[model samples]
Target: MSWAAGEFSQEEDRYSEVLRRQWGSPTLRGIYRDAYGADYPEEADPFGFVTRTDLARITELVAVEPGELLADLGCGRGGPGLVVARERGAVLRGVDVVEAAVTEARELARELGGEAEFAVGSFEQTGLADHSCAAVMSVDAFWMVWDKPGSLAELGRILRPGGRFVFTTWEPSYLDHRELLTEAGFEVLVHEHTPDWLHRQLAVYRGILGHRRRLADEMGQTAAATLIAEARETRSVLATTPRVLIAASTPA
Candidate 1:
């Protein structure tokens, strides 16, 4: 089903449900393994295809330090969170609305022996303590949220003084996405487009499509069909949504 079909009141519920169902399926796990490799290896970083480049950009803007507390909003499968936790030795906590994704991420954290925590909850209303985190990061999942302003404010609330917040969204040059950070209360720290960013994004989508085909051939038609369907749905949304990378600091 198209993302637009869901009502605002149920958007998180719907997204979490869809992703949970998808991730829980053994067929889908096989497809993910074949397509993205084993849970974003240290060198390979499977999420590299999805959000690695942007995550790098965001990290540079935020400058997280070792032993500091970091929060990852909309932490899909905890790939980006793992990266930061591993790289910075930060106490990382990843929160997502999807229960299955949270479970999967927690399991991956245990398996990888990374010092990271995963919680199933919405970004807007995570029960985290106020002024608790040193940095907050998200990757390509803000569009699914109903209240961007409220979410940003919540980010601000959770950050310690001088804390940084960073995330990547579809660039406006490529899609007609909305701006939600500034409206909430963040002062933008970096707001420049990368070279050939649109081309790079399109290439990643193409890569996903190609991987779906390859997996289908190796795993049989059912697995292939599901991956293809999910990829198509994601492509359709991204094709029309604006993309951007935003980093801001909570005012001290």
Candidate 2:
């Protein structure tokens, strides 16, 4: 599958730099661990759905088994993927466009004692083989794929027949976008909207800005300020943003 370089495709490097700094920060890691029991490598997404409860739900939803290959797209730092690997007893393979994220993911696997592999790659161009995986998932990372159609096609190509695909992501109009999946030929099994999850995530971001002002400032004055403003003005940015704990699978 090929994609014309669009907004997200153009911003790949920018996204990498932003996440590299933010996700690599020790302060943010400590906060995530203390507040969420994420005793793993993570680049905490103040705007993502990656709590223990959510990971647990995804683990069961994906129905991965021992020795199966569980490919994690946008696997940043390996926290979410590691949880699924350990819980489901599946071997994990993660890919991220950010080289730093891939590096951290490798270290994370060693530190956490999980069976996993990591590579620097992108969603639309993941370098895995056709029908190479038993299941594929992305925790709070699907929206980052700029070329939705192309990426979906790539995912479809990489997953074997009957493989499950699950993701926790946000969609402004969750129901209106089901056509994307249908067009990509996925059979939707679950498509539940999660408003409370968005609200809670926004609340967490707001609380972080309030309590970790210094840390936020250190992250980048402009970015932190903008994020804080967005948090405060969540009426549009997040207050009504619907997150989805959606799941789906390909035909056998």
Candidate 3:
């Protein structure tokens, strides 16, 4: 997710701080591992509800060929995109608004020895060439964009003809997500319910609440407090929100 429209710099600084603090918390990592089990990426640290299985599904659905460029929008820490690119033999271009996230993603790519690049960009202004990517993938970050139509249009602009855009996001019942995709000139291919997402996400939140002391020790009180607050805020809608994995494509 990105800032409401013009507040990009503020959100960038804020999220960069969050990433610097949150990524080093062993307690948080444990919470994710405990909740997700083998589904969590051991090397790529992604901040989203898309489990390892969800990522695998994304990898398969993207259908990227070897040497093709795959764009990962809102790519936090660059883990999921790196994993997908490696699995599919694709070059990765990861974009995030957070400078810290882009930094971490670049480091992760170097550590993993993958053909990838990370950039400071957002859903609305991805700095990529038109029709530059064979596929695009986003984890749980798509819903946070305030300018959904514009972002979708940006995705359409960057993706090649017939290229896939696969992502996981939560939608309230009132929103017509498919309509939005169609309006942006994409053909909705698959939109499936991810029933396990709620339970897994709740478990992570509960784990944070349960391990407050440890989290504070590792991530600092302010960061832990922020996580606790977000966990609490997220719990209110986890049940009502519908989690989905969607795959769409540009005109062939």
* C-alpha local distance difference test of each model: 0.63, 0.70, 0.83
Query: For this target, which candidate reaches the highest TM-score against the unseen true structure?
Result: 3
Off by over 4 Å in 3: 1-16
**169: Cα error in model 1, Å:** 1.2
Q: List the residue pairs that clash in candidate 3.
A: none
lDDT of 2 by residue, 1-252 (tens): 011221112234434445666654556545555555442234323324467667767888889889999999988887788878888999999998878778888887887776899998888988999998899988767765668889989989999998988987766634344678888888888887643465456555655566557656567754455445544544354433467877778778
Q: Write the per-residue lDDT of candidate 3 for residues 48-157, one digit (tens) a residue.
A: 67677887899999999999999999898999999999999999999998887888888889999779999999999999999999999998777767788999999999
Q: If scored against the real structure, what TM-score would every candidate get?
A: 0.72, 0.82, 0.91
Ranked by TM-score, the better of candidates 1 and 3 is 3
Q: For candidate 2, report its TM-score.
A: 0.82
